[model samples]
Target chain A: MEDNQKKYTELANRIYDLDGAVYECVGSSLGRTFTGGRERTVRTLSMLMYTKPDGHLLRSELALISNMARTIKNKEEKSRMMTEYNEILMEIEKLPDVFGKVDILDDERVRLNLAAKREKLSENDHLVICISRTQGSAGNDIGFELADNLKINYYDVEIFDQVMKRLEADKDAVNDAENFVDFNKYTKKSGGSLKTRFREFNRYHGLPKQDAVFFNMSDLICNLAKTEDCIIMGRCADMILKNNHIPHISLFISAPFSVRVEHIMAVRNMNLKQAVRFLKKMDRQHRKYYQFYTGEKWGKPENYDLCINSANYGIKETIDVIRRMIGK
Target chain B: MEDNQKKYTELANRIYDLDGAVYECVGSSLGRTFTGGRERTVRTLSMLMYTKPDGHLLRSELALISNMARTIKNKEEKSRMMTEYNEILMEIEKLPDVFGKVDILDDERVRLNLAAKREKLSENDHLVICISRTQGSAGNDIGFELADNLKINYYDVEIFDQVMKRLEADKDAVNDAENFVDFNKYTKKSGGSLKTRFREFNRYHGLPKQDAVFFNMSDLICNLAKTEDCIIMGRCADMILKNNHIPHISLFISAPFSVRVEHIMAVRNMNLKQAVRFLKKMDRQHRKYYQFYTGEKWGKPENYDLCINSANYGIKETIDVIRRMIGK
Candidate 1:
């Protein structure tokens, strides 16, 4: 990937160098105002008269000169400037090459072609899109919206429902296992005294049932992949598809902690303490679940084709960006 | 998480309702300009005189009235406008309240306080920072920069070196094992027919030696964590620390694929194809390695305290943002 960028960068740099030389020939550097007074004015006037004023430059120079001419109070000075401009114009009329330097246009075209080639080479495989997101990042919302816009099937609880329907797995048992594992971690971190009763229940129950449910869910995910192009949220879908050699675009959506907490606080009507605790607990469970089943970090950027911050970009813009990325 | 966000949305709606009423008292709707003509002007003038103008409102109103006066065509009309403005000014002078509405300021203060509170709540376990990054996201660069800025001890391959020096493990064999695991998956996905020779070599040689190396490295990581606050890069340090109940901030850094590819291409002096291939292989190995031992997603955002895009924000800004986030 790095090597690819280098070639493009090298091409870009070369284009800039060639273009810069051409720019110097016609006067004025790219991205800078024409500041060299009389010399710049003369060169610009000559270029305008000689070259087919590539619309942008022509419009700018015409505006500048007309504005500058308007500011001149002395008719004699204005007439002198007009004479210089006309002299340059007459000389330009005699020139063979109408475009001051053709190299810049050629260079720009080459640069664009190189960029296009690089883009083409980096296009992604798009059989499926597996979206794994943090709890409060609005990953599910983005997934549903993306699936709707892309007109692909979306599977969130449907994946769990499908597995449950097919395998007769107890949903409550799975939830208990997931909650227990996360709760156990939190309790262990917090010294376990406050959650003794829950700990006692979890200690006897364990996560074996959850493990069975997860394994079956993995198979169900693979089966779904074999059948359709869909947007699957969570459930370690990205990992499952990758392991099975299924082509997919994996997406991870996240937001900064403060934004997420605020989101929770507003949505749950919880105080700061409650919102913080809820966010931490939910995130812990998600991490544990992904780690347990896929042995991969749930929110790792590399695991996904796109990593978006819903809070940073907002849902609509993020979705639009994703659509453009997917070429949909 | 969705439940939590819903409550916050409810509270925000309530705040808007309350604020809207207060805004109506002030004779203008929030976030909208008064588009009504003479009646609006009279009401605004009356409000400016009768009610106290908050500094923000005073500034805005002064600017708006000054701009409005500039548009008067006739000298007599302008004089009349000035007289009316002077009357309002005189009335404002007699009034005791300089600012009628204080809700906006109070609202702003509440927002700041809420933000501060959230920041305080998210203050992390800072015993160690285990940074997991993508192959060409400049994760190591950011890690080194972060460690230097925070004045913490930094570890990248120092852990591997420490483990290797202690165990005398065959480094080449370990590399071969890592390469093999990554290559194995790729070939498996590609149908395994063409790369059979490489697979045969990897299958027999296996990763036992590397596994030994990894185990020793995990012990080294824990021992180091027991001693000091340091930033450790890669080698699934985040996972090991988490399981051991060591308090740490795990960070995942990544960039878009094209950006990473360009980085690798330039840094490694490889062509686009070579860079792309290299990145894929390296990433696969990193993922496999992290999952193999830690059983966690290598780049999952949930696994980290913060996840940044070096390409999106740029490395310097990303580092600064992380530093601010960590309060270092």
Candidate 2:
């Protein structure tokens, strides 16, 4: 039911249009020249200046602001923006930054680098490919096709040893997160030890590990985001590729169940139907993995740069379509 | 990849065809046939006479007898036929001899008194039905459709529990016959065991239970071949259904793997292409399972009464064609 990549590109263009609107909002807010903190002086006179196509703050949204601020070409204005954020913190009734030690400017700069890495701005960022497969579906074949075309690395996810290593590192975190009773009661981002562990586990174990040879692949991905673009297969890559400016494209490829069944029978040598039932389970696992980590619902248009149906477009055409869109 | 019921009928009609072709051989054999060890003599002779289309014993083979017999139609001249089996031994042999010396004819005559069962038969010694399926080709749907059309019992094979009990009781015999070795070989067929105990733990823990349910379902379907004229879905039904004179019309329904994929995707709500891989594994399991149980290669035209490609013949027309064939 997803629109093709051509449609997806049109949608992406609209999203970029929204970005222009957001920039305009910021301009309108700054034009007011209201910049103090006392009496809860606004960071921007009105958020109405920025039209959030989707309203509500995102998880870890200060990162987005930092990314946007980093793109500001003027060095003085970038530093000034950070100072303005610090001033907003002081104006809020909550508390005063007595020492001015938060260093919001440096934090934004760090976020800028992360966005750069996520976008693969330089040459060294290797593609991180993720894949979600059904029992009878020729997932490996498709992943191979895309990787061959893209000339990037590829891997199947069944190697449990590497997955476990990723799992072990985060076990304590996930257990802690689950065990944590009070989430949101502290400002230090405490609790969610289990969630953290699981997320890390999914990032590695859930991922095909060839790209994971890098230590701390997630961080590396964030770092790599600034270095170069990635062509990741399913494994929640859209979620991993979260930055608006990361220059990475997200894709979800699928075919009709019957077509999958026939292909399984012919190419994969499956029985008449074992794959049909399996597809349901895999779909659940895939969507949960994506939604759980990325906090972006899987298969949603907003989550992917392109969601393709190979049934409609055929495999080769689907990949080509994706290439064209990613190029854009 | 297969022809229709005409091939089966052609194979059946061959008995008549060869009956005429071998007239000279029959006359010569009968003329010189010796009285001593006549049962052995006839047994040896009959093996050389009737060769089915693909050179295996016919599924319709009731007795391993030559197209030409040594008997004369006239009772007075029948004394000459005494060179072969005695009448008493012949009568006993022709009856169900597997159990040894039971009043087989009288037993059948007695069972005929069961009104609910025998009432439907019109001078018919036996009733048989055949339904064939392809990998992910909606054979279950077709099986159910045929049953509904005929107003007969339709078994989905998945929910039937008695199959497991039969498998348990019948496991040793099956193992002996085919060198069968299931990986989960030791789980108790009759009752509770460690595996079952662990399963109970899962129920207590509220784990979704479909996995266990399906495994047991396949076990139940293993023994469903005892009844005649029933449509069974992919659980070694074709293998178990083998019997001579029962007209067990083996059919293989095929469709392009892509078509099967679509049917599954639309019916099951799968994403575009995810089901392709899974359909492959399931088909292999069914084929292996069939070969393991019956020692007959699955999907061989010789193994089937009729094999139709559903893609070539649409579902409705396919069903109609099968029905017409059965009506004859």
Candidate 3:
């Protein structure tokens, strides 16, 4: 719990630092222009990070503004601009204090409801949690915390890695299968001549290497479920468990794109552009991978017993909810 | 389509006007306190609307700031504040244009992809679309637009309104049934002394008036489904149709909480606090209503054929996807 609090504080400080940089840029820009408001400042910053092709403010753009400002040769105007700049700097200095207050507000909003103590359970008790999360929603962190709290084994990408290793499989095989499946889908959609299409379909997915990997992975997951209580993350574990008639709580965690972009930017120390690109790519890959294997939509609520927004309800609070659910 | 464009333009203008007011207030406030920056301006505006109990900025707060400004007696300091005030007002004057740019960005974001011309279908073509949406997700608008585009009838609140009128029912009875069901849920959760709880449950519901109303509403919806191709919205219509084994597409539409709040605030002409309150209440009411009838979690993906985010993909693109699905 103390570690959790420390992590949050660290995150809060990171946000403060980023917001500080943005606040300074906005203040300086406004000081120079004397023609834009707070909304314009935020919009510019957001656009630079979220919508700009490069996903960040171009230094060239800043330099261009500076060049324009330098061209204003009137001595009086230049002196006035300096005064405005000084005033803006003074305001920028106070931003940390304002952000401190905002941090407190966010803390209040995210306070986790700790679970009550539960009765002792026998070793044979059946409990499995399959948690799937969108990229940048901190699914891994939540999975770890929930597992630690529940005193259960946690499996994530490492499990998939170990299984692939055991099978002596190449990862690219999965990509090939995914690509083949995707091509099949497009061809099916386009509708070619019947005989040609039937031949193509038969040749397309004849138990490809990726399907072998998934089959092996599902068997591994089912074997794990039968052995002990555990929290499994991703790799279509939920669908596999469901097919095996394993009664378990399936959970999907997601956040808004904006929130996720912010999270990835902060956590990964990536600029806005990189973060957006990374998250979008990951989401698409996960969706395609899940859909290809299960023939079901990824992150669809019906596939999961619980669908939650970790960004809306804080991760700790979400875990708390899950704890209560497990108890029931 | 032209009317839709007009409405969006009007909404953008409304946002511009509101932002103008906020800009003025922020400008004047900043002029008084040279220690504040863009972050402070936005935080203050957000707090005034979203956190304040009255859901708006109080006149008294503005007056107090004025009074404090009047008390500052230093000539240089006073003159400096006035200069800052003038500069801020100058910036405020340029806000409409800034907002115009943002509006265009938003417009680009929400642009709908109109569907390709679809083939004509027979009257008994077995096409029913049941759409359930989060409050303020513009579900009703989407439903109406989808129905119009498909040249099918749309049923929403009016259907429930008609059903209630025919049954000579009041809305509170519905609320009571929801409450009774919620209580029964608690009793079940508690696993109370079985005999007493069973008797209490039997005596409590006993074919309540609200259930009668629901029965009629369900009948009305099912009859409508039998008649023609149509889109049904809300009042657990999706669940009702599903129970009746109606062949249809069930869709669930959702948006991020902040997006939904903004939608309600703008469209309902409510302050941020009021909008948030109203949406939360409506969501709770809906969850209870749906759970009471279906004994299923509202907004679960399994209950629907397609789950979408209007905020993510825009309403028009969502409609386009639905159209393609229906055609297939």
lDDT of 3 by residue, A185-213 (tens): 33455355877656654543655444555
Candidate 3 structure, TM-score to reference: 0.33
Among these predictions, the greatest DockQ belongs to 1
How high is each candidate's TM-score?
A: 0.36, 0.26, 0.33
Candidate 3 iRMSD in angstroms = 26.8
Candidate 3, residue B34: lDDT: 15
DockQ of each: 0.03, 0.01, 0.02
Candidate 2 falls in which docking quality class? incorrect
Residue A150, candidate 2: alpha-carbon lDDT:
65
> Model 1 over residues A55-110: C-alpha lDDT tens digits?
22332332233223323456776555445433433443244433221111112222
Q: Which stretches of candidate 3 lie over 4 Å from their true place?
A: A1-328, B1-125, B163-206
Question: Candidate 3 lDDT, tens digit per residue, B177-273?
Answer: 3443343343355355768656645643665444655776788888878776677787787777756765555667776577778766655557999
Across A182-251, the per-residue lDDT of candidate 2 in tens digits comes to 2223335433477764665577667422234322434444553454333443445435544433434434
Residue ranges of candidate 1 with Cα displaced over 4 Å:
A1-328, B1-20, B26-126, B167-207
